[model samples]
Each structure stands twice: as structure tokens, then as C-alpha cells.
Target: MTIAEAPPRLAAAADASLRWYPGGPYDLARTLGPLLRGNSDPSFSVQGGVIWNAFTTAEGPATVRFNPAGGAGLEPWVDVQAWGPGAGAAIESVPRLLGAQDDWHGFDEPAFHATLPRMVREARRRSLALRLPSSGRVVDQLLPIILEQKVTVIEARRAYRYLLHRYGSPAPQAGSLAPAGLVLAPTAAQWLQVPSWEWHRAGVGPQRSATVMRALRSAVALERLAGLPALEAATKMQAIPGIGIWTAAEVVQRTHGCPDSISVGDYHLAAYVGAALTGQRTDDAGMLRLLAPWQGHRQRVVRMIQSSGFRKPTFGPRMTIQDHRRH
Candidate 1:
């Protein structure tokens, strides 16, 4: 999707601020929620009503601060600040990051109005404010997903946190403007330098580590995918050895605000979605069939159903625990 026009320049460039308005009702917390791994995630954080992210740009590492200046509805303009060598590029992408660039496209097709469940329809009307955020940082988003491949959520999260704390640097040139303890994920070169033993220690197996190395080797090319269409970006991500449909969909969902990409292989998504929509668990194929009517807006439908309080029954484990060490 095309980016919204460049945000208006702030009066002062102390931290390189850019003022921007959303194309629709924009909810700051909801838009940003999916990008953050968890509260303790090192690469992204929310503190003191300010959202902080440290990212890798072609120029260098940059620290971004999103400060929302109040107004009602779409008038709430966001003032974004950036620091470090890549500050200019980082400042320029703030609107895209918050999904201001996302367009609903054919979601409003007249024939599709009643296609969604009544609960979700109500949610859609109330949640026009919900947006799909795009960080535009490919590798930073990829590594953690690599860690998650075929593993439990606890395992992936722990490994990611370990790697970030061990290899990530404090946001460069951020000085006092950045929150205390804010950290950036490792740069592409730094990722390649992580020792085999360290990967083992982080709970990443040989196959997953190999995938990480492959992705880093093609870092420049992979980073360019951020500029491509979300569908095309997801397709290109599969060219990497360890990336697959599931990983690609998850990555592009955040990096490109891909509305149609589905987490087809996510172990629990099918069941969760199936139960939410039909009150009975179903497999991935069933889930896809159910979502087919809204071809271009499947993820949006999923998000609406998810936010509507319908949940998969508690008859089974919330998440699968597949031990990868046996591999």
C-alpha cells in the first residue's frame, strides 16, 4: 500500500519531529500492540505513554519515539522523534509505522456487508479505528519469528530476549531522550557474529540458527522487501531457507500491514478462528474456507473476531509444546 503523504514538518527538529494525521480513526495502543512481543521485549517497548522502538535502517541504527498529541478522532496528530544516523529515514516512516498508510481497499464491497458474523460486524463498526501497523524493519522482525519456528511460545520469547540483551546495544545517539534501559536488536553484521554456542544457549537449534544466518547473509535484499506489496513481500520472504508461509505471513503482517496474509500454519490459529466463528474447532483448511468470502480482508476479519471476546474452548492446551531439541 502507498504511504500517506509525508507528515507535516514539526516547528523544531530537536529530535527530528514529524507531525502526522491518520487516514481513519487511529487507536494508538491497538495499532502498536501486535508489534510488541511482550512487555519485556527488548526491541520494542511502551513506557510513560511514549512508544519506543530501536531499528536498523540502511543508514544505521535509529531510535524512534512516538508521542501522541491529543485531539478527537482522526485529528489526534502524532509527533514522532528520531535520533542517530538513520534519524531522517526513521522520522519519515512514522506514519507508515502506525498504519496511516493502510487503505481498506475492497473491504467496503457492498455485497460483503453482511458476510461477517453479527458480533464481528459490530466490532468492525466500532473498530474502524483499528489499524495494521507496519514497522518497515524486516530483519529486526524476522529473527524472533525464526526463533518461533516449530517451537513453543515460551521458548521463542526467551530466546529472543536472551539474544537482544546479550547482543543488542543501547539505542545509539539517543542519549537522555530515550527511555532508560531501552535497547536495540543486533545489526545484520552483529547477527552473523553470534556464536554457535550462543545460539544453543538461547534454545535455538541448529536448523533455526542456520535459517537466521541465511537471512542475515541476504539482509540487504530482505530489507528491500519492506517496500514491496504485502502479498509480494510475503512471497519473497519464502525465498529464504528457513522462512515459510507461516513465518512470512506473520512478518509481513507487521512490516507491511498485510491485510490478506493469513497465518495458515499457526498451530492454534485455525482452532481459535474456527471456534470463534463457528463455536467448534476446525483445522487450517476449514478456517481458510470460512475466511474465503472476505478474501482481501481475512486478517481484518480474524482481528475483529478475536477482539469480540470469542475464544477457543479450554478443552486443550492453549499452545502446543513441541520440543525442538530432538531435531
Candidate 2:
């Protein structure tokens, strides 16, 4: 299914401030772009007119489309010209998730507001800034975080792309914004059915793959966990066998904009936060102390720091990519 042209109103929304998709809102596909682009390991094969990684911006509910009129592959599928509620209401909510609304604008505390500007300015000199976009669905966002546990990003992304392409379905349409080889992510049932060899083929080792299967088996229970507070959600996610503090924090931060969910186990986050906040590199405890002043809004502050343009020096050896497929 292809949309020939993005309806006129959606074009206007794109003109305003929405950065991710100028066309409209994508439900689950929104998460895919970040996963693919953030880490190079999930390199999608962009063959055919199907720009599989493109996010669909419909006037109503979010969906993954092939070529829904607006040009084939990555042209940005959108439908915003309609005036009625069905799709239109969904379109309006897009801005809220993107933080386009003014009410959601302010940082939680005034003290944070005061300190962040300096940080932003400092970051500006270095050409870095923190950015946060509402990633729909806690489960979708949490998956990669879970896969990345105690491993390199390259390893995690490789595992993700392989899993999705092999087990996920093809988008209803041929070639659109969805990844060329990817359709929707594996459903809970599908996840449970995957064979052990397929996991190995996807470069996901046994441990992470098994954890994913367990989570998928309980997908319904996990989806219900969405509305919980970030901390609470983090706790629930951690209860899973392979998931841990760092992964849960990583997932919650993007899933709900949780203010205090600093990524404690990230390979580079603590150092990055340390150098960004203070001139020197620090460990997890030090990073927490630095962010303590903005306790309730810690995630927000980290977003600011990232957006502020600070860069952690990178002289150390990068983590080598390990292809579990060979194992």
C-alpha cells in the first residue's frame, strides 16, 4: 500500500517543527528508524522502491506502510489533510510525543532551568546537544536495550536486524519506509516460535535471545506495564532474567522521558555524562552525584547535556563487533 501524496495539512505539520517525520505519526515504525540509524549494525537493505526505514505519518493512528501514495520508499508516507477525528486526532498527538507542546516544555524544576542553559552554552561551543523524542510503546523501545546488555551497540543492532528480518513479516505494501527486509517486529507468539539456529544466525547469542523469547511470551503483561511510573516500569523490566539496571534505565528514559533514569550500565554514558557535566571523567556514582541536583528531572538534564553539544573524548579502544552468528 502506497499513499500517492501526503495530505496538505500533514505537509504543514512537517513545515512547523516535527523533525522525525515531516509526513505524519508512525506507531511502531518510529522506533525502527532510531534502532537502525543510531547504530550501524542494523544496516537495512534498501532495495526496490521500498524505503523500509521510512516512518509513516498518517492523519489518524500510526501504521507501517509500503508506498502509500507519497512516492515510493522513504518519501515519507503521510496523510494529514483530513479534518475529521479518526486519523486527525492521532495526528495532533504527534507533537506532544515530539515535545512540541509548550505545556510539556519546561524542565521539571526551576533550578534545572537555571543550570541547563550554561550547560547548553558550553555544549554549543563543542557542537553537541541533547535530544529526546517520545518513543511509543515501552516494549518496543525496551527490546534493544535488553539486547545490548553487557555488550557493544554494534553487537546488539546486528542481533536486532537479523531477528526482525528473519522472524518479522513483510510490510503489507512492497517497498515503502519500512526496512527492505523488515516488516513489523515479531509478535509475542512469533518470538516464542523462533528456532535456536535462527537466533544464532541473527548474531544474537543464546542468552539475550532466550530473554527476548521470555519477554515476548509475556508481551501482554508487559504492554500493560506501560502506564506505570518510570521507576516502576524500570523495576518491572529488570525483573526479566537478562534485563538489568542499565538496560531498564536506557529503555525507560526513551519510553517515558523518565527524568531520573540515568543509564547506569551503558558502556560510555557515565564517562560522557561526567565529562559533559564536569571537565573530568567520572564513574557511575560520580555521574549520579553530578545529576543529583536535578533528581526528579535527571533524564531531562541528561537530554539537555546531550543536546548542549558536549563531547566526551574518545581515545580509548572501541568495543569490537562480535558476530555471534559464527559462534
Candidate 1: tens digits of C-alpha lDDT, residues 1-327:
233322554324445666677744667777888887777898776877778888877777788877765655335656677888888788777778888767775786666785667766776886777888888989888888889888888889888898899999888656555677778888889999999988988879899999999999999999899889989988988998779999999999899988889999997899887877778889999999988988888998887666555657775855656555454
Weakest lDDT window of 10 consecutive positions for candidate 2: 54-63
Alpha-carbon runs more than 4 Å astray in model 2: 1-96, 100-112, 121-131, 174-182
Count of clashes, each model:
0, 35
Lowest summed lDDT across 10 adjacent residues in model 1 is found at: 1-10
**Which tens-of-lDDT digit does each residue in 1-327 have in candidate 2?**
222345454344232212234333232232223334353332233334322232222222232222222334553433323222223343444443433321223553355455664664454333221234454466666666677877787677767776776766543332223344434555566678888898788777888878887787777777666677768988998788877888778776666656578888677888888887676888888989888876776776676566544678984888877877776
Count clashing residue pairs in model 1: 0
Each candidate structure's TM-score, on Cα atoms with residue i matched to residue i, is 0.90, 0.70
CA-lDDT, candidates in order: 0.80, 0.56
Clashes of 2: 35
Best by TM-score: 1
